[model samples]
Target: MGKHAKPSGKSAHHAPGSVVRARPLPVRSAVRLRRPIDIWHKPALSAVVALAIPDLTLWALGRLDLILYTSAGAMCALYAHGLPYAARARTLPWVVLGMVASLGIALTAASLITSTALLVVCASLVAAVHKVVCEATRIGPPGNIILTFIAASAFFVPQHAGQVPLHLALALGAGVLAWLVCMAPALIRPQGPERIVVARALEAAAGLLRTEAGTGGGEPAGVPHARHATAAAVNAAWHTLFLVPVHTAAKAAARVGLERLLVRAESALGDAIEASAEDAPRDARFAGAGAEADRLGGWARELRSGRPLPEVALSASQAEELAGVAAEEPGPRRPAPGQPRGVRAVLTRLAPGSPLLPIGARVAAGCALAGWASMAVGVGHPYWAVVTAASIYQANTTLSWQRALQRTLGNLLGLLLYTALLPLMHLGPPAMIALALACQLGAEAGITRNYWLGSVCVTPMALLLTEFGSPVPATTLIADRWIDTVVGAAVGLACCVLVTNRRAADRIEVALGRVAAAEAVACRLLAAGPATGADEARDIGWARERLTGCLVELREAVEVAAGEWWQRALPEERIAHAEQRGHRALAGLVRRLSAPALAA
Candidate 1:
């Protein structure tokens, strides 16, 4: 929505008294293609390359039936791409392990259980794990869907206890290869991920300026979302910076350089917030802020160019603020007292009442229903149905509905593509294998545009991967997957509606209560006096972060709840009051800690 669009609840200029309504289900917006991510090719290229060696070697050896295991591990390369190499190195192995474990469970259950019904139940349970764990780990794109797809497919494959270890070993080998492939760029460009995140911050900041200038003809809506996005990008940059250890003087300097750019991005974001409250009419300050935004955009370009971080001019206060932030990080490896990390964090996520558990339950129910329905309807590939249903469970009912629509449309298109590619499959193994590889690559590349668009490649790719085994008739394959897709989408959407995430709505109350408590702490700290020692300053900064985080969580909780079909009305007045007070206290902390580096 651009210049002419009206302000919605999330818009920066919405009146406080205006009604806040749930977003009616998205249609045109759900399927619309947006701009590509900053380094969209990284995961796409990484996944396809990681898959190629395993696929070709298997094909050459007449063992392409094992692609499921290797593909599971190869897809590991898709994860941790956004994390700094230091973090990526530590995280990728765990991702690989999780993938393999999922496959193992599926295979063992498939081998032992004679009943097809029990097998579907086992597959659904695995899907539930895949959904919860992936979200808990915060692993990025392709996410649990890839894991579930592979494991569900494996559940249908003929397996014995004897074959499990060898298949697992193949997956482990491919996973090791995937790790190396993802990490290889570090030798040449150690800070590439860090730089990419900073560049994104700059671009987001620039968009704010364009809106301020009212030069681009759009609603000036999504301004709030952009502000939050820029903040997230900057936080990611800081996290990446923390991942870089500083044993050498040279490394320390590189980190400081990147930090300076991040500070500028934050400063631009601050200006956008101030600009939002003004009726400046393109006045001098707005003009100058616009210029500053342009400069940030240019520096962002420099960051992505594989060149050195461009020298940025900053005032003494800005430098001090940067130093203050650097001092506050406490290194990336350490977890805070309340924020449980690693396994503890995973358990915390699975804790009863956690929002993620509800979503996981939805996946399990939807997958079971979809798979059982497929068998009832006489479709042969119930696993395909299972995977589709598993993939459709999102954070809430509305989003799941959106994904369902996109998935159904994409699968239909993918079937048409498969028909057209019948001749290519007849070209034999290499051609068939290569075509599937292209689908993998295309899925990664286009999926970011829209899930359905990516599915155009994914659905066909899923079908083609089956061809690696004894060939199935194209007509039978197409018809089965098509039926599965429709059944899965319908069942998944139903589950989403029936399985309301009440916790998300409840979380809004929790967040607000936390905000009220945090605001009181911040207010007391502010009243105590200006931040003096490193300890006091750190406390203030931590308090600010917590308050800001709670506000974001509260806003998000409200949004998710409002979209849910059967949720109760939110306490909008309380939420509004909490955010307003929390923000005021946070501003005080920011001003005390680093007024010049950040803004008022």
Candidate 2:
């Protein structure tokens, strides 16, 4: 179709009979350094404390050789740091349990089998499971890396039937400690996680406002990325609010306070849409957007600090809606009857034709191939290669390639750092313990800066961890790790190239259908609204949220499919049309439900 011609049909990403091919890896972007994440210190500090208490206790008992089990458990602290406390409370125990289970399974297999080949296969399967389950649970950041690392490492450890239970128990004990350490902050600020997320939503909304708040604005000029960020942040803030418990008066008050600020930020979002969609510069309803942006930023600053939440006088309908929200709080929105719920939801996500399943298959194939290649290359510990392969798999093929590149570079740099630390590490367990803890701290604290930076610390830490059990020849160990890194990165990329994700293309169609369905529901709710009651407004808001979520999912599916190396040509035009329509409808619903909530 010509530029000015009406689009008659969806255009596939590529023409029929054309072969899909991989693009150049994102080498520079993968390694580039950036600022730390907002909660970087939480997981980093929690890991340090989690490891220290158990390590010191083990040392006192003269059982420092069992550091692997404890370290495995301690790493559980790295997960769920991004979750609200209410969710974290329920999630942390499961994470700990999963960690222990992974350890137990690996240990049992190792004890029963003497074949390094069999062991590698078992560990690779563990990595695959970890990848799928962690994604299903939405365990944010460092997702399956820690789980795979623990399982793969355990697969090579010398274990007997007698030792498996004890090891798992040790892991469980230390994981409990990590859980306590992670939850400690709740004692002082029960709403801390909610506050941070709410602040982030406000800040993101303010960012969008500033983008369009220009004096010489044309079409309001909000960047796509800024709008997307605002939408995601506001969505996350509401999720956190729902997950918060409100049985007590104090907790209820705190939730309502945060909800008030979030309501204002969401209103700013709605106004931005109204202002941009109508292209009316002099519209009075959108005139207060700048003032709203300033309030959002100020409220965000206050939320971030230890100060009280900013007070807002919600109009009557807003108050009634909030009161209803409070009444409905302490749980996630219920799924409709006959729809997948809880475990079923996870299973549904993992069911046939799901995009994540292909990635899991990729991990299994990559790790196995990398391990076999490492063994063929005569590396002593093929599991290192397995772990490296597992770490490289990300959400899509392109990201996997970038991680493969980054991991390779980071491992080389990490080996150099290990050599430098080798002398200090020879000072015995005490010095080794301190250095390992320091590396743990750096890995968590700096990972948000960039994955490659975290790998730099991780490499040295892994080498030091080995010394805890029994000293090895530094040169031999270093040489083996170097070899494994090369083999793993090479083979992992090979698997990614060879094992194509054709399902990714199909997912775009499913996502588009979901978006259409959600949009229809949103349209119905919007037509019925200027909701008279809290329940009706809540219904409109829910419809809008579902529609927005479906749009996000559609975008993700399209992006992932587009990045797959051997994917069939996706219907790019169809995806764009669906997303544009879905988002436009969502913006309309936002105006209807949120914009006037704080107009006073």
Candidate 3:
């Protein structure tokens, strides 16, 4: 039996000393408050260019009515943020195609079915499918929720079979435009994305070093956050590097150099974690790590600007240490596998036992309920309520609550902006297009900073979209929005409460066990002494990878479970202990791999 396993006969329902308690709303820390400006510039520019150029052209051609379909396709621009150009090249097209496909299905369903009940069912099914696919693929933010929002709303749009192809063509054209807009930067700076990702990792490493040094070896509260940030940055850097195809010797060499730098960064991270855990004194090694991190960050900046690669420099001891580790010759890089193919595979992966399944079900239920409640209460467009409900379903109930509050607040303020702009919009399509573009820019600009800030623009843009078909009175639109917001937020949060994830704690225990098991396996391998052959070395590498993956999974589980309300008190202390042990085990593995060089 595993060390972390529950004692026999102690029902899973009742872990020893565990008590059910309601987790209070984390009001202060729920939403990130710091607003950064530069990070959003490129995405905002991409969205505006993607949306405006086509819209203005359509208006010029007297095809302003077709802008709705085109804008639906262009909305795909909102995705692919933080992805490397290589990944974005694939991701953007996928998003556009997915949007077009969903639109086609919605249009067909609307044309074929006359009954509202059937339409609702169809929309609910689409939401479920989107939820499953997005979660399975790990598409990150702006996930399937936005895609579902667009499709669900379109389901109610009156359409004919003949109009489907033309509308789809419009969407396809705009999607192509969005793809181009997002990919354009790659033309000027082929390695820019990878550079940024690597740079971020280095910066995060430096941050952790600073925190460790400043705390005088005490485990500060900020240390975990910094560690997690560094881990995420490193993971993203590797993924980005892997996504880029190396077609030339020059590119391959460059990639190898980046990989070497990345390994050093990882080593530095391991050192910091171990030092912090052991409460070691700040030493020359720590200072050297910080300097190396700064150097790597500068290299990233130069790469991003298409400047020449900086010369690598290190002290004699540092060079020997790196050379010792490099002598081991780590395992060959295996191609990262793609997401599982086929609906069956995806569904199986997201089966009832999966953590994401409950969230998907909650989304479907909330969307359906919000739509029905809105219609019951005589709101003209139930889709708004449906979309609102979809948007409120985040990774956890705590986040969902924050989104609900942000969405409501932003929408209310947006309605006021819409009211103020109503007179200007009546001037012409050009004015309306300009206002929409501005709102989109604003949305993209602040979205990363804060959800509410982004929604301030998103709400107005959505309201203005209603004006494209026919003029609805501002008062009526405002009233409906407020009513829908209330209904959807209330319904969505209610679903969150009713559908509690009892397995959350259990999953945390499982993750803890996995981490323990993997750590033990790696530690055992290290204790057996350094790898004597290629196969043994590869085995050690795989073991370390498994351990790292388990640690990542464990951290994610703890974060999600921590945010859940009304659950048994988690064994947080035990989880922390496991993490510390895991880190020490990893550090030991790193030391063993570098032992040959260190000894020399």
Q: Best lDDT goes to which candidate?
A: 2
Clashing pairs in 2: none
For model 1, name the residue pairs that clash.
2-218, 2-219, 3-217, 3-218, 3-219
Q: For model 3, how does the per-residue alpha-carbon lDDT over 300-361 read when each residue is reduced to its tens digit?
A: 67656667665554323234433443443343234222323346656765776888878878
Q: Residue-pair clashes per candidate, as listed? A: 5, 0, 1
Candidate 1 or 2, higher lDDT? 2
List runs of model 2 lying over 4 Å from the truth.
1-22, 215-222, 282-288, 329-341, 595-597
Q: Which stretches of candidate 3 lie over 4 Å from their true place?
A: 1-18, 277-293, 313-349, 531-541, 593-600
lDDT of 2 at 166: 89
CA lDDT of 52 in candidate 2?
92
Q: Whole-model Cα lDDT per candidate?
A: 0.77, 0.79, 0.74
Assess every candidate by TM-score: 0.90, 0.93, 0.88
* Candidate 1 lDDT over residue span 1-600, tens digit each: 211122344443443323443345667877889877767788888888899999999988988888878888998998888988888999999989988998888888888988877788889989999899888877878789988988999898888999999999999999999999999999999989888887887887787666666534232557656655665665556556656666555766787788777656655655555545445344643667666777878888888889877887654555654566555434452212465656897888688888998999999998999999999999988999899999888877777878999999999998999899899889888997899889988888888888998999998788888877547888899999999999999988898887878787678778888889878989999899876555565566567556656666676676666667555556656776676566557556655654544331
Task: State, as a TM-score between 0 and 1, how close model 2 is to the true structure.
Answer: 0.93
* Clash count in backbone of candidate 2: 0
lDDT of model 3, residue 178: 90
Ranking by TM-score: 2, 1, 3
The prediction achieving the highest TM-score against the true structure is: 2
